[model samples]
Structures are given as structure tokens and as C-alpha cells.
Target: MADISFAGQVAIVTGAGNGLGRDYALELARRGAKVVVNDLGGSGSGVGASATAAAAVVDEIRAAGGEAVANTSSVASREGGASVVNSALEAWGRVDILISNAGFLRNGRFEDLTDEQIDPILDVHLKAAFYVGQPAYRAMRANGYGRMLFTGSASAMFGHAWQTNYAAGKGAMLGLSNVIALEGSAYGIQSNVLLPTANSRLAAEMDQGFMEIPAFAQALQNADFSTSDGRVVPEFNTPLALYLVSKDCTATHGVYSSNSGRYARVRICAAEGWVAPRGATPPSIEDIASHFDQISELGDFSEPMTVYDEFTAVAKAARKQGVYP
Candidate 1:
């Protein structure tokens, strides 16, 4: 296959100072994108901000002969979101891709999760995607081309012990991206979600001791974990992210999990189960108890393409059972 290049495209990567975001920004720039490297430079818990983190990434991009500009704006507020996009417009004239990868986590069990922990996590991971995408979306609509990617998480899909706030925030991103994909299709804009697992500061914060885990250590011992034998360190989970935001990627409203150089698509589907008989007045407790297994079965399931699909299924079932004339 031919090489995929961004060429004249402009990309905005949030939290681009380091880790996965930095990897994404550099890769996009190397592939010919003029990038906006946005980083609030705050601690992992989302307190305070600095310009150094963003500036350093931008400096590195330029030194490597790639174009980049720094923006130190929080993704948790409307003003901050607008300011980041404004920096992109001022520096590059237009935004063709938005990689909403900015996020922070405060881990706690469900019972211990506070409003303080819940609010910022949602503000940054979910709401900020909306704030930044809105303006960039408008620009894309006018130009008739755009690609958007939201950073989702495996914790949201598979559950995590001490990550109620984090999981809730990431789960909301799936809904956000799905809606954008549906709405943006007419305007030539596409949106998708990515669940990435990588060794970043956030991962380090999750458990510093995870680095020394036996499984990871074993892989390192075999040299299987090395992407570049001691010199050019590889951030393996980034390719899926870059592909999702590339112009050639026509896929929309999809979810994917990526890690350790492997990628897989994730999907949400409903189970097909029991259908009530004609004139059934909300099956009794005894009746439901008897059919519970059948009611929960997944065999012969139907995928609902829209909200109306559920209504249509109900209507059809009613007619089939002679419940409706």
C-alpha cells in the first residue's frame, strides 16, 4: 500500500506535551500536518497550568523540521477550548482534524467518588470534546471535509475498580462521538472513538509499580517489547489514533481498542430474546421468572440502527402477535 500522508492538513492534538499525545502530534507532523500542540501542563490530577510543556513539544517539532505551535489552555472550560482552537486557526488557518486526547484521572472506588472528582473528569474528557469540536466542526462543514477522534478507555467498557469518575467520563465520550458521527455525515465530517492503552504519565500515576510487573518484565526480557532496540522508543498504540483522524478513513461512529501495536474494533449490540404474546398485559412476576433465561438470550439479535428501529421492532412484533389491528 502507498504511504498515508496528511500533506496540507492541519491537526489539533490536545495534551500534546508528552506521552501518547506527544507521540500523536509528532507523528502527524512528520506525516506533513501542521499541528497545534496543546497542553495545559497541569499535574495528572488537573491542578494548575504552565506553558513549558506545550512549548517544549512545539520546539521539538520545529527542530525535527515539522511545523507546530504551542497552546497552553485547559480543555475543561469553554474559554479554554475556544482559545486552543483559536491558536490553531491563527497559526495554520484551518483545522482539518481534531484529536481530542486531553484528559486526567482521579481514581477512587464508586462509593468514594465525590462531586469534585466527577466534575473535572467529565468536563475534560467529555464536555471539552464538544467545546473544541463545535467550532472546528463548523469550519469543516463550510469546507466540506473533516475528521475527529475522541480518546475513550477500556475502563469504561470492561470496568475498573478505582475508576468510577474516569470510567463515567470516558463512557460519555462514546455517546458524544456516536452522535457527532450521525450528525456530521451530511457535512462530510466523520467522528470515531479510540480506547488506547499505553505507558504514559497517567498510567504511571495509576500504579508506578505496574512498570515492574512480571508480564511486562517478561516481554521486555524477550525483546518483544522493544519497538526500536534502545534508541528510537516506540509508542505503539498511536497508529490507530492517527488512522482514525486521517482523510482516507471513511469510517464513522465506530469504537476501537488499541494497545501494544495491536488494534481491534469494539461494538455495542442488543440481545435478542423473548417477545410477549398477544394481549399480554406486562407478564406477571411468575411468568417473567419462568422466561427470564429466554428473555435474556442473545441468539437472533437485531441491531438497531437508530432510535426508531426499536419502535419499528415493537410495532412489528405487535402486528405479528395480532396485538394491533
Candidate 2:
């Protein structure tokens, strides 16, 4: 295959002021994409703003001989999201890729969460995806080709103390991406979410001791993080992020993960559930309890690519057990 190139494509990368988002914007720019570097320039906890951060990235890109523009907009608001994408359209005339990587950390225990603590998390992470992603999606559909990369978190899939709000917001992006993938399938537009485990500004600010766990701590201690310009930059997942949104990658309706250079696909699947005999009345509550183990078993689970595919898998499972023809 020929070398992957963004050549004439335009990309909008949110939260490009620093860390992972900055790396994504810079790399995309290096690969020939005309980039819109959007950063809220807020505090790590999701407060405050400045336009300088975004402009700094644009400067770096320009200094390296790449085309880029700065956009200082809050992804948490309707107008802000639209403005971010509009920056690219106004400058480049078309939008081909969107990297929704803007977000902030607000960690609070489950019981401690209240309207004040959770709203910002929901606004910036969940609602913000809808706000900005929709505009870009429309443009991509019109052009009949596009790729999107949303940021997700492993904490949501598993569990992380003091991060209830953050995790909830992150988890919600999967469903959003799934729908976009289904609808955009026919238009040559692909949407996928990334669950990256990296030492970005947000991840570095986490104080829950989760990283102190031997598995994570030892890895970081021993790992030789590949650097850029003499700095130990461990956004090693950036390369995978590039491939995921590239024209060469046709992946959609999928949640992929990368960390410390390790990569994998994350999925929600259904087990081959226990079935009652054909023509029998619905099983009793006691029957369900008796077969709980079989019903919940993951040993033979199947991963469905779309909602309709899940139904097909269910029907096949039923037929195998004589519950369907």
C-alpha cells in the first residue's frame, strides 16, 4: 500500500493546547493536514480560558512549515462547538476530519457528586461531543467522506473511585459514536472512539492513586517513553490515533484503546443466553435464578457491530436452542 497522507485534508482537533490533543494536532499537521487547533484553554479542573494556548500550537505548526489556525472556543457550549468547526470551514473551505479531544477532569466520589460538581463534566465531555461533532458530521456527510475520533476513558468501562462524573461522561460517547457510525456508514463517514491511557495533563492530574498500582507504576517506571524534541512524551497512542482517523482505516462502530504503546479494541458483547424449551410458557423467576450463571457467562459471548446485528445474534442463539426456527 502507498504511504498514508493527509495531503489536502482539513482537520479540527479540540483541546489542542497541550498534551495528547497537542500531539494529535501537531502530528496531523506534519502529515500535511490543514489543522484547526481548538482549545478551551481552561484550567485542568475545567475553569478559566485563554486564547494564547491555541495560538501557540498554531505557531508551532506554522514554524514547522505546516498550515494551521487557532480556535479558542468552549466545546461545552452550542455556539462554541460550532465556532470551532467553523474556523476550519472559514479558513480551509471544507472539513474532512474531526478530533474531539477537548475535555477537563473533575473527580468526585459517587456519593459526593451533586448538581454543581457533575454538570461541568457532563457539559464538557458528553454534551460537548454532540455540540461540536454534529457540525462536523454534517459537513462530512455532505462531502460523502469523513472520519471522527472521540476521546473515551477506561475508567468508565471498569471503575475508578472519585471519578463518577468523569467516567459517566466518558462512557456516554460510545453510544453517540455507535449511532453516528450506523448513520454515516452509507455516506463514507466513519466514527470511532478512543480510550487512551496516557500521561496527559488530565491523566497527570489524577490523584486517586490508581496509577500507583504495581501494574501501572512499574510499567511507567521501566518504560522508555519515545520523546519529541528531547522531552519524554508518552502520548505513544498518538500514532494509533492517526491510523484510526486515516482514510486507510475503514473502522467504524468500534471502541479502540491504546496505552504505553499497547493497543486493543474494546467492545460490549452478549452471551449466548440460556433459553427455555420451545413452545413453553415464559420461565419462572426461580428458573432464571437457577440459570443465572449460564445467562451471564462471558465464555461464549458474541460482539455485535450494530444494534441490528445484536438482534440477529439473538435470533441465531434462539434457533440453536430450539427457541426459534
The residue-by-residue lDDT of candidate 1 on 81-154, one tens digit each, is 89888987898788899999999978765676799988999999988998888888887887889999999898
Residue pairs clashing in model 1 are none
The 0-to-1 C-alpha lDDT of every candidate, in the order given, reads 0.83, 0.86
lDDT of 1: 0.83
In model 2, pairs of residues that clash are none
lDDT of 1 at 67: 95
Identify the runs in model 1 with alpha carbons over 4 angstroms from their true place.
207-234, 312-325
lDDT of 2 by residue, 61-112 (tens): 9999999999998999999999988998999888999988888887665776
Highest-scoring model, lDDT? 2
RMSD of each: 4.8, 3.7
Candidate 1 total steric clashes = 0
lDDT of 1 at 156: 92
